[model samples]
Target: MKYDWILFDADETLFHFDALKGMQLMFERKGVNFTEQDFHQYQQVNKPLWVDYQNGNITAEELKHIRFIGWAEKLGTTTAELNTAFLEAMADICTLLPGAKELMDALNGKAKLGIITNGFTELQAIRLERTGMTHYFDQVVISEEVGVAKPDAGIFLHAMERMGNPSKERVLMVGDNPHSDILGGLNFGIETCWLNVHQHERPEGINAHYEVQSLHELRSILLA
Candidate 1:
């Protein structure tokens, strides 16, 4: 293997992250019809909050409760209740991306696998457990618990500590987000692979050591 440790981003890289569907399912359980408009409205608040969270302008707890505040008021519930329900709904629908399992199965026993995600802790555990993907990872680092999100050296440093401080050259970070995943790893002095499945344009001032449109392509590249 080319690398001793392979780190992956959870949402949209290895796992399918369909927030719209998850939100609909969450509201349905509460006997509320969550429409397209409702989801858009939710995103108006949620998206900016994420940017703020990643930029270190807001804490995870603030982002969690603030995004669901309006919905909670309408549903006669607390933001905590709504947030937990949404996570549970997301877990119920958790699924690996195409060829994700094949990649993981192939990599197992060949190299160490780890997940470093900005995704919440509750959703991470349940999703991995529900999808039967728990055992594939040697490390699961959540930004919520680590007190720092990606693009911050602290979180990467934390992951490196848990990884037994492997040589940076022998570790690879694979993720869908160019800013948080690729750039972050690059800044931390490690090789990175951008998983651009949607064929998105490469962002400015950022470059990955490798780029692949699918996990299958990644598997081929890594095992070559």
Candidate 2:
């Protein structure tokens, strides 16, 4: 079926976020004297904060501060220092996934494209703009901005509304996360595409309309 609008997820879908590795390297380079265990612990603290933020239980600012505060409490560091380091490291390593630009270019003008991500609006926008992907999207609906994350259906609804409410059958949702992107799109009655970057098994009972192992595969599918 032909789709009029294509919605994409950002982090794992469009960009490769080596969050743990990057944080470890950045701390070492900055003389923070943190161990890999510390980085892992920090990530453990940060992930749930993002989930909470996506669930609308916390503001973006609260999530940001909480991550650093939790890490600092664990590592005996100041929150201010941890926050600065985390932000700097995140900004430095936020690179696009391979073939992301090409796929976006390939889809350009062929179908309306937009971003529906469960991330901080400011950070998500900065990542897209910095990676030269800002212009490719017709709209970017961040969960933080919308007060709801994917799998909840509200976020997808927000994206659909922004896309002029294209027929559900003629809309495609693409992302890496099965829980968020795939399940969310299915819940919204839109076709879902799983960008399975890691070759993850398709979860039982939650099938994607399309499956791509890479961005190049996405381009090929669009061309087909």
Candidate 3:
């Protein structure tokens, strides 16, 4: 492997985080059928909250609560209760992305691995354990615990500190988001790989050092 340490984003990079499905499952437990229209409306409130969370303009708690406020009112439940149920539903459905296990297996002995996620603390650990991915990572940094999200250098610095201060040149940050994962690694002076599964156009100035469509492509590049 070219890099000594690999830091990954948890959601779409390693796991399939289907928020709509997870929300539907959550509401199903509450005896409500969450439709696509409901999910669309939820995203209208949730997406911008995620952006605000990443920009450090809001706390994770705030985002969690505010995004579910409408649903909570409709369901006659507290936002916190809805939020916990949503996370639980997400955990129940968690699975590794295609080739995720194979790539990790290929890289396990060759390089050290870690996860730096903007995802909530409640889901990260359980997903790792449930997916049997716990042993593959040496560090798991959640922005909620750090009080900062990705695209910010602070969270990256915190990750590096826990990693015994590995050389920036010898580290690679991989994720699916161009703004957070790519830009954040670039700002922190580390190599970056963007996992653009949807073939989205690269944003204006956020250039990743490498780009691949899937973990298999990444493994080919790294394990060659």
Candidate 4:
């Protein structure tokens, strides 16, 4: 293996995070018909909160609370209740991305695998368990628990410490987001691979050591 450890970002990188479908399932469970317009409205609040959370302007708890404020009001419930419900729905619908399992299987014995996610702890555990991917990882780090979101070096440092402080050059951080995953890993002095599954433009000044559109490509590179 080229690297001793392969760190991954959860959500879009390994798991298919279909927020719209998750929200729809959540509302359905609550006896509400969630429409596309409703999801659009929800994103208007949710997206910026995530940005703020990643930027350290807001906390994970605050982001969770604020994003569901409108929905909570409509549902006559507390933000905590709605947030929990949404996470539950998301967990129920969670599945690994195509080729994700194969990639993990191929690398299981060859490299140490771990997950460092900005995703909430509640959904993270259940999703891993449900998808049967829990045992494949050596470590699972959540920003909510660590008190630092990605794009900040602190979280990467925390992950490294937990990883037994391996040589940074022998670690590869694989994730979908350039700003958070790639930049964060690069800034932390580790090699990075940007998993641009949707073909998004790479942001300026945040180059990755490798870029691939699919986990299959990553597997080929790693097992080459």
Candidate 5:
């Protein structure tokens, strides 16, 4: 590998984070049939909270509790319980994205690996463990633990610090989100690769050092 350190974003970049499906599974366990309509309603509240969360306008705990307020009230359950259940449901359905394992296996020992994620702390460890990916990473930086989310320079600094403060040019950040992962890494002075699996157009202001449609493509490029 060209870079001494390779950092990844946890959610869609490495794992499948199907929130709607996870919500449905969560509601199924609670005996509430969660429809697409309910998910849409959920997103109306959830999406803006994520924006606020990403902008650091709200804390992780606040984001966790606020988004489920209506559903908690409707179910007569605590938001804490609802949130924990949701995380559990999400964990139950978690799987590595295609080429994820292949990339990891190939990249092992080629460069130090780490994860910088905006995902909740509760899910990160468990999912890594369950996916048998725990041994592959040297550092796992959670925005929930760092008190700042991506698109903010603070979280990246924390990650780089944990990475033993490598040369900025010797690092590469890979993620699916153009704004958070690509832009954040750029601001932090590291190279970035966007995993544009959906083939969306890159945002006007954001530019990554590399863009690949699949992890296999990334692996081929890295090992070429």
Candidate 6:
């Protein structure tokens, strides 16, 4: 079947976190003063909190404040200080995944392209704009912006609606997370592609219509 739109996940799919890590280390060298342990703890606390937010157990403001507060407590820093430092550091970092620009350029007018991400809208926007990848998307749907996260059919439907409600069979959702993007697409009755760059095994009960190791594979899949 020919697809009319291709929706992508941002964090791991289009933007690589390795770039963020490098920037974080640069911040550490500049005396922002976070140790490896501190960073790991921060991530440990942050990830689950976002999952809770995605699952509708917490509000966006609450998630943001609480994530920083939790990190501050673990690192013995004040919430205000952590907030300032975190956002500054994140904005300074956050680079796009390798070949992201080329792949997007290749698909520019081939079909409709959109972004459906479970990230903070402001930060995601900053990252995309900084990487020069924002203009490639016809629609950018962030969970924070819509007040609904992935794995819920609502976010996917919202993106589809933004794309003018194309037939479900003719929409492709590609993302790195199995539980969020893959499962969410399945729930929305759209074809889903699992971007498994890390060589991870597909999670149980989350079947993707296609699996690709990199964005380059996308062109072939869409044209196939």
- The sequence of per-residue lDDT tens digits that candidate 5 reaches over residues 97-214 is 9999999999999999999999999999999999999999999999999999998999999998888899999999999999999999999899999999999999998999999999
Candidate 5 stretches with Cα past 4 Å from truth are none
Model 4 weakest 10-residue run by lDDT: 67-76
Comparison by TM-score, 3 against 6, better one: 3
Tens-digit per-residue lDDT, 97-156, candidate 1: 999999999999999999999999999988888888999999999999999999898999
Question: Candidate 5 at residue 79, lDDT?
Answer: 96
Query: Model 2, range 51-100, lDDT digits (tens) per residue?
Result: 77656688766776777776577668777677666656776789988998
lDDT minimum window of 10 residues, candidate 3: 68-77
Model 4 alpha-carbon miss at residue 69, Å: 1.0
TM-score of each: 0.99, 0.87, 0.99, 0.98, 0.99, 0.88
RMSD of each: 0.6, 2.6, 0.7, 0.7, 0.6, 2.6
223 Cα displacement, candidate 2 (Å): 1.2
Query: Residues 97-197, candidate 3, lDDT per residue (tens digit)?
Result: 99999999999989999999999999998999999999999999999999999999999999999999988999999999999999999999999999999
Tally clashes: model 3. 0
- Candidate 5 TM-score versus the reference: 0.99
Cα lDDT for residue 206, candidate 1: 90
lDDT tens string, model 6, 1-224? 37678899888898866533643664485566656776687678778987898788997777778867764676687765655565656767777777788888877787788999887665677787888887888999988788889988888878877888888878899999998899988988898999998879878888899998888776667657
* Model 6 poorest 10 in a row by lDDT: 18-27
